[model samples]
Target: MGIMEILMIIIPTTLLWAAPLIFTALGGTFSERSGVVNIGLEGLMVIGAFTAIVFNLTFVDVFGAWTPWVSLLAAMAVGALFSLIHAVASITFRANQTVSGVAINLLAAGVALFLVKYIYGKGQTDIIQRGFSKIDIPILSDIPIIGPLFFSNTYYTSFVAIFFAVVAWYVIYKTKFGLRLRAVGEHPMAADTMGINVTKMRYYGVLISGALGGIGGGVYAQAISSDFGHATISGQGFMALAAMIFGKWHPLGAMGAAIFFGFAQSLSIIGSSLPFLENIPNVYLLIAPYVLTIIALTGFIGRADAPKASGVPYIKGSR
Candidate 1:
C-alpha cells in the first residue's frame, strides 16, 4: 500500500481501539486521584460490557440504531452500583484496598459469567443487531491530508472519548472539586482538618471511576466486540490501568497513552497486511502492547508517582 493509504487505514483503526482505553484509563485516574487504588477496574469493565450487551440485545428493536448508545448509559449505572462494593469494603470498612479491588475483579467476572449462563443458556450473548458505525465528519472530511487521516471513516465514540478526556483534564485541574479531591488523595488528614469531608470526596472519585469505566466497557462491546463473552473484556481494563500509570494519572496523558497502545494493538491486528510488518512474527505483534505496558509501569519511561495517600485507607482520626 502507498504511504497515504497506510496512514488512512492505521489512523482510523487506532482511534477505534483507543476509545475504550481512554475511557477506562480516565476512570483509573479518577479513582487513584482520590486515595483509592481501583484494582477492580477490570471487574467494573466486565460488568459494563455484560450489561451493555444485554441491554443492547434486549432493546435493539425498540430503540433501533439508538440501542447501543442507550445501553452505554445502562452500563454506567450498573458499573457505578457495582463499584460501591469496593468503595464500601475499602473505604467504609478500612479493608486493604488492593485486596478489595482484587475481590471486585473476581466477583464481577463470576457474576457476569453466571448471569450470562442463566440468561442465555450459553457461554456468551448473541451478537447485537446494531452496533456503532464509522462516518465521515461533514466539513472536516473535505480537507486534504488531515481530513482523510483524522476525520474519515471514524466512529463517533472515538470523538466522544477524546472530548471526555479534555473534560476530564479540565475537571481535574481547573475545578474546586478537583482541588479537594487531590487534597484528600495526597493528605486525607489535612483535608479532613480543612473540612473537606475526605470520605465523601473519596466516594465521588470512585463512583466517577466506575461510571467512566463502564462507558469504556460498553464502548468496547458495542464498537469492537458486538457481544458479551467470557473473553470479550479480557485484559483491556488492565491495559487501561497501565495507561493511567504510564500517563502519570493525568487525563490527557492517559488519553495519549491510550492512543499509543491502540496503535500497538491495531498493528497487531493488521500487521500482516502491511509489507513492512508482514515479515515480523505474529507473536511479537500480539505481545507488543502488553510488553510496553510492563515497561511503562516499571519506570523505564521515567518515574510515575502515584498520589501520596493512594491505596492507603483513611481512618477518621488515626495517624
Candidate 2:
C-alpha cells in the first residue's frame, strides 16, 4: 500500500484503538494527580467492558442507533461503582494502595469471567451488533489528503476523547477545584492546612478514574472487541497507566502518548495484512508497545515523576 493508503487506514484505526487508552490515561492522571495511585485501572476497564457489553446486548433492540451512547453512560456508572471497591480499601481502610488495586484487578477479572460463563455458558458474551459508526465530515473530509486523514468518518469515541482531553486540561489548569486537587496530591498536609479536604479530593480523583476507565473499556469493547470476555481488556489498563506516566500525567501529553500506543497496536494487526509485513513475526509486533512502555518508564525519555503522595493512603489526624 502507498503511504496515503496507509495514512488513511492507519490514522483512523490508530485513533479508534487509542481512544480508550487516552481516556484511561487521563483518568489515571486525575487519580495520580490527586495523590492516589490507581493500579486497578485494568480491573476498572474489565468491569467497564462487561457492563458495556451487557448494556449493549440488553438495550440494542430497544435503543437501536442510540445504544452506544446510552451504554457509555451505563459503563461510566458501573465503572465508578467498581472503583469504589479500590477506594474503600485504599482510601478508607488505609490498605496498601498497590495491593488494593491488584485485588481490584483480580476481583473484577474473576467476577466478570464467572458471570460471563454462567450467563453465556462460555467465557465470553455474544458479540453486540450496534457500535460507534464512522461518519465522514461534510466539506472537511473532502479537502485534500490531509482532510481525509483528519476529518473523515471515524470513531465517535475518539471525538469524545479529544473533547474530554481539552476539558481535563482546563479543569487541571484553570479551575479552583483543580488547584485543590493537585495540592492534595502533591502535599496533603499543606493542603489540609489551607482548609482543603484531602480525603475528599483523593476520593473524587479515584472515583473519576473509575468512571472514565469504565467508559474507556466500554468504548473499546463496542468499537473494536465487540464482546465482553476475560481477554477483551487484556492489559489495556496497564498500557493506559504507562501512557499516563509516559505523558507526564498531563492530559494533552497523555493524548499524544495514547495515540502512539494506539498506532503500535494497529501496527501489530495491520502489519500482517501488508505484503512486506507478511514475513514478520506477530509476537514481536504484539510486544512492541509494552517494550516501549518499559523504556519510557526507565527514563529513556527523561526523568519521570508522579505525585509525591501517590500510593500513600492518608490516616486522619496522622502524619
Which candidate leads in lDDT?
Answer: 1
As a whole number from 0 to 100, the lDDT of residue 258 in candidate 2 is 91
Q: Which lDDT values do the candidates have, in the order given?
A: 0.93, 0.88
Whole-model lDDT, candidate 2?
0.88
Q: If scored against the real structure, what TM-score would every candidate get? A: 0.97, 0.95
Put down candidate 2 lDDT per residue, 1-319, tens digits, no spaces. Answer: 7878778888898999899998899999999998889999999999998999999999898999999989989999999999988888888888998999999999999998999888779877998999887888777778897788977867768978989999999999899999998998988888998999888998899999999999999999999899887689989999999889888888898988899989888878897776677799878867777787678778887867888888887766788
Give the best candidate by TM-score.
1
In the predicted model 2, the residue pairs found to clash are 135-153, 136-153
RMSD of each: 1.2, 1.6
Residue 131 CA error for candidate 1 (Å)? 0.6
Per-residue CA lDDT of model 1 for 120-169, tens digit only, reads: 99998998889898999999999999999999999999999999999999
The global Cα lDDT (0 to 1) of model 1 is 0.93
- Candidate 1: clashing residue pairs, number: 0
